[model samples]
Target chain A: MLAAARDAFAERGFEGASIRGIATAAGVDPALVHHYFGTKDQLFLAAVQAPADPEELLPEVLAGGPEELGRNLLGMFLRVWDGPARAGGLALVRSAVGSEWTAKLLREFLVARVLRRVVGTLGYSPAERDARGALVGSQLIGLVMTRYVLKLEPIASASRESLVEAYAPTLQRYLTGDVVLPG
Target chain B: MLAAARDAFAERGFEGASIRGIATAAGVDPALVHHYFGTKDQLFLAAVQAPADPEELLPEVLAGGPEELGRNLLGMFLRVWDGPARAGGLALVRSAVGSEWTAKLLREFLVARVLRRVVGTLGYSPAERDARGALVGSQLIGLVMTRYVLKLEPIASASRESLVEAYAPTLQRYLTGDVVLPG
Candidate 1:
């Protein structure tokens, strides 16, 4: 069922994929899907086997002071990528890259559950918050692509501590520093 | 020849695609492929219809002072993406994402022709140079993915001038600022 869901999502994207279609592909009754997964979003979360549960992990990352938020965020990111959850994260990224549905699902999940929450604490204007969130997203997504997927040298080989130190400052700037956005 | 080469490169990647193979695919003699393209590398450059000639554009980007290097790099990047070259750039990126051969080709091209040149201009240790180059690569690649390929909101809608202002400082930091990488 999960596999079918993944295929459907990858092929059709979020808006186009249907629970009934997934159930039919899985050779299971539609009621079984609803019974097991509750909803399409929930099924996606399960199929992706998300590397981290943002609801559970975000508080731990957010507990520190604003200055250390970048460090904490990156630290958690590295942990998710480097630790036992690495496979799941890699799978999600591969699927996201291959499918617009997966990309949209992942993007919405990150924005609503993670980035928005972090930006909410910072108290910027809506536009500023959106800009900052996107900037932060760019850095994180780039880091993942170059370091993990493409396996670019130096970065792919760098120690966890080195990456955290090098990236945290940039994240800090995006999170709270002065970023000029033209009107 | 170019269309066949593009399809071959996009499907099989650089290492896998051969002059003879391209010729066969195009229903031409292998000698004709050599006659026109001279070499695989030359053929790739022609097929991708690369937006900026690195040799010509790199000097212009690197001529400015270090403080403005990030801005110049991004300015050139945005110009390449926003101008008539947009189609070529988009095709290259899409092919790169679809095939490891294309990714490797793109990576080597960027590193050898562009990033290394920029890093070489700055007198850093070999290790530091590699690290800094990768950092810059991450930001630029991420920006392209979000702004162009995925069409992420806010970033996709941002004006060229606004993106330049917002991203230049981060690029500057990655290029010349103090990036600590533990030994």
Candidate 2:
């Protein structure tokens, strides 16, 4: 059912991928889809998939303290995207491009589950946290777009460790460093 | 003719938008479009649009040297997009999304025309320069996506000066910061 859901969502996008389509793709009755998932939104979420609950992971990430925050965050993200299953990252780019609902789902997941927890734990003002969150999100999303979607040259060729070494500090600056104006 | 070409390309996407359709829209001879643009590729470029040659702007930007590179580049970009003429930016994004040839145009304009010149003036190692270039390109492209296409909240609402202040330092970092890992 999940596999069918993935195909339907991927091929047809969120609006076009109806519960009936998923049911038909899975060779199950449409009523069974309702019985199993309750709603199309839930089914769509299930289809694109998330490896773990970010809410659970984010708190533990911050518990090590703010100093290691960038490394920990980047490392965790790198692990997920660079690990055996890379679908989450690709599906995410597709979602960001596809529909407002998926983009909202992504933004909520990032803000509530991942960023808010980490930033809330930090001793920064709302503006600071928002700025930092935006920069970090931009970097990570940009990295994924280049590495996974566009597969642009050396970036795609870069090893996971190399990427972390190069990028984590950029994240760290957003996380902690003072903002310096361009001269 | 140009108006028909633009609408067809924008609506149907590059592959889907045909010269015949454009001709039909324009109420002109198809041979006229062919005579004017020469090929579909050239027509796509015409449809996508390019700004004043980055080459023309590069010398002025680099005149202040590396110290002010970030400010100049980001400022020039914002001015271009915010000015009376932003159809070019819109065309660029539309083409980048819609067609490979158009993406090549973006790469040439973005990577070769804009980034390579700026990074070339900087003295980073080839590998480092490439990575840095990608980061800058991603941020700028991401800015266009957020500000122009997706019309996301804070970014869309952000004043030009506010955005320049917010983004310039990140661009500066990508341009010349030592790639250090978080402690």
Best by TM-score: 1
Q: Clash pairs of candidate 2?
A: none
List of chain B TM-scores, one per candidate: 0.74, 0.69
lDDT of each: 0.79, 0.68
| Model 2 chain B worst lDDT window (10 residues) | B96-105
User: In model 1, what are the clashing residue pairs, if there are any?
Assistant: A13-A101
Q: Kindly give the stretch of ten consecutive residues in candidate 2 chain A with the minimal lDDT sum.
A: A104-113
Docking class for model 1 is acceptable
> Compared with the real two-chain complex, what DockQ does model 2 have?
0.13
Per-candidate RMSD, Å: 5.8, 9.3
Which regions in candidate 1 have their CA more than 4 angstroms from the true location?
Answer: A1-34, A38-44, A47-49, B1-35, B38-44, B47-51
Instruction: Please give the lDDT score at residue A120 for candidate 2.
Output: 70
Whole-model lDDT, model 2: 0.68
Q: In order, what DockQ does each candidate have?
A: 0.40, 0.13
User: Candidate 2 lDDT, tens digit per residue, B1-183?
Assistant: 888876676556556778999999999999999999988767866665765556666787788888788878888888888875577667655555545545545554555456777898888776667678877776777676556544444565677777777777778877876654211
Tell me the docking grade of candidate 2: incorrect
lDDT of 2 at B77: 85
| Best candidate according to lDDT | 1
